[model samples]
Target: MSGHRKNSSDIHTPDLTSYPPSPSPSSYSSNSSSSKSSSSRNRVKGAARSVAGVFVSCFTPPEEDAHHNSSSAYGGSDAFTSSSDISGASDSTEGRRRGTARGIYATRNDSTHMKEPGSTIFTLAEIQTATKNFSPAFKVGQGGFGTVYKGQLQDGTLVAVKRAKKSMYDKNLGREFLSEVQALSKVEHLNLVKCYGYLQQGDERIIVVEYVANGTLREHLDCFNGNVLSLASRLDIAIDVAHAITYLHTYTDHPIIHRDIKSSNILLTEKLRAKVADFGFARLAADVESGQTHVSTQVKGTAGYLDPEYLKTYQLTEKSDVYSFGILLVELVTGRRPVESKRELDERVTARWAMKKFRDGQAITVLDPKLQESDANGPVLENILELALLCVNGSRKNRPTMRRCVEVLWNIRKEYKDLLA
Candidate 1:
């Protein structure tokens, strides 16, 4: 008899010749003999069929073969097989073979199943329809992330959809999305932007946030020609912004650093109330314990408001927020962009120039001319400017805590009211 040689394509077949057949009985009932022989033939044929079935089922494209056939002993060869080939006369043995084949099929299917991670997945068709096929009329603004569009949901809720650029979908983009969601979801203050939801499909990363119809503080400041906002109004906006920062730094469980604190990130309502927006680079201080914070990663922030210490060390903390907020305060008082004006090279950034004026006991020179229109209480500007100076101090340790800064602004607001009374 030939030695049983199993090939890779014969996984379910056993070498029937290897196992000796049971001895035939000298005499038996005709029905019993016929049934036994019939069962044995079926067992052998079924095993062979199963082997062929398994081989075909397991076959896959070469690229996927590494993943699908990891445990396969055949090693992609057509000539080798496993030890499944065998013949048996018992019905129980035949049943067990079928059960084994079924199990193998189930395992193969389970291994092949691919599940997607949790994210906002919008069909291209759906997004196209939602934005009216990317109509130009709906575009709100172009940003570093991508272009933003104002859209209306079926439920009549207004949404500002930020359609991120394809470049934003890099390897670490998923981490940025998770970071924004985790940080924004925790902060709930009147002066902080509200995140509606997010969507990520293919190369499109969409962030849907509340539509601040009034636009950014930067827009208001720039459009007003230094005459739009009175000193009192500016002071009010400053107080609210300070409160928002304080809430993030001290009130939240883990402090959040708003890495980008430019005027554009400071949104406004129709009533001129300020709300802080954008948290792409925000991180938890607790994560520093795990050596994850900063981690010598590439820097991320706006040009004008970035903390110099953070730029050097990449070690971001709540004090970095204080420094940015100080820059914002100077912008409020002087109505100057953080950068120097080309028309007057002598003028430094509002923060440095104001600090110099404060040191010289000549803060009025740093005050925005528009602020004088309301004859608003000068004492409030003095007190707030003092706090702003403390926040913008070059040494990180000298920056005031957001909580104390909030109290100082509040006290100044009260002082204004008392003086008016």
Candidate 2:
């Protein structure tokens, strides 16, 4: 919208990895089993190639794929079921089944898109050895789901492995995991986190993610005592995040509502760029007419940013994500936690307090105290404050879509460029 040339090195560029195109309603409802299976297989292969290529291109001295011919990965057991749910049938019996299913001609619908023979099954011990027996030093963070650790593979690839509690890996959880994979495989955006793969071994479950070094936006905003971001940088981050959400809600065929949108879930890269993470609470907006489409589930999401309409009706829509994104914009603008407020007389949430000040033309009072001494009056800051106000409007329908938000921010960025030049 600004007519400015975009950076070739920008993370959002297309050459990085092609995102799977979202499946249409017709594709989703395809009646032909063979056609659907073929489509699914094509999607899976495309995703795998893209991910593999990304790692190869970025990390120097690329390594070959671990040879699958050797049974060494699973301790010489040709048909060992690493999943705890599967029983230990003798290798003689299981090996025959695997061999019969080996040839591409004999393929049928399998739970994992990959043919049985080509599947690389890593033993629990292999992971344990790779992770140094899950030592405390490797621990990254703990959340309601589980603990994540930074692991370096024998091949020297860095990965973030999440170990989930047994209950969280139940059958229902697996379905959700598949859905999450479907959602992420088709989405490649700078502001969205990248998921590598998932593994299930007996009772243990692991989610391997691309390791991002900068940590979460919450940590950067609230925890980092010194080195606060310049006003321009903060606005840039807000705009980037908004653009990502815009892509999710508007670009996808079935609009995705990021049910949980909070600073803690927004991870930062080494460059201090933001990427939305944690899709456990995300859901697709159900079609209005198809009663079967939008199944209602327990209301899930972070509290401070949850949508009131969704909370009231148990029905979520894209607007719900817009509402949450608005709250995030407010957080970026004020450097205040969603709920934090020090106002003595009126201990209202920062969103309300900031909006009040914004309307009164005294929004400067709500600026992060640390920014007071700096050049906070610049056009970038003014545009950011205005965007924050638009995001937090009382009515959800009044909020701008992510595309509109991106355009507005792009304009502001152009203004900033002109001012500087």
Cα lDDT for residue 224, model 1? Answer: 45
lDDT of each: 0.56, 0.55
Task: Give lDDT: candidate 1, residue 67.
Answer: 17
Question: Tens digit of lDDT per residue, candidate 2, span 285-359?
Answer: 655334332335445666567665555445455656766777787788678887754555343466666666765
RMSD of 1: 28.9
**Span of ten consecutive residues with least summed lDDT in model 1:** 104-113
Clashing residue pairs in candidate 1 (N, C-alpha, C atoms within 3 angstroms):
7-79, 7-80, 7-81, 8-79, 8-80, 8-81, 13-85, 14-85, 14-86
For candidate 2, what is the lDDT? 0.55
Tell me each candidate's TM-score: 0.66, 0.67
lDDT of 1 by residue, 130-223 (tens): 6776689999888655688887755555667778677632434444554565565454456877665566565666766667888888877776
Off by over 4 Å in 1: 1-129, 168-175, 224-227, 287-297, 373-376
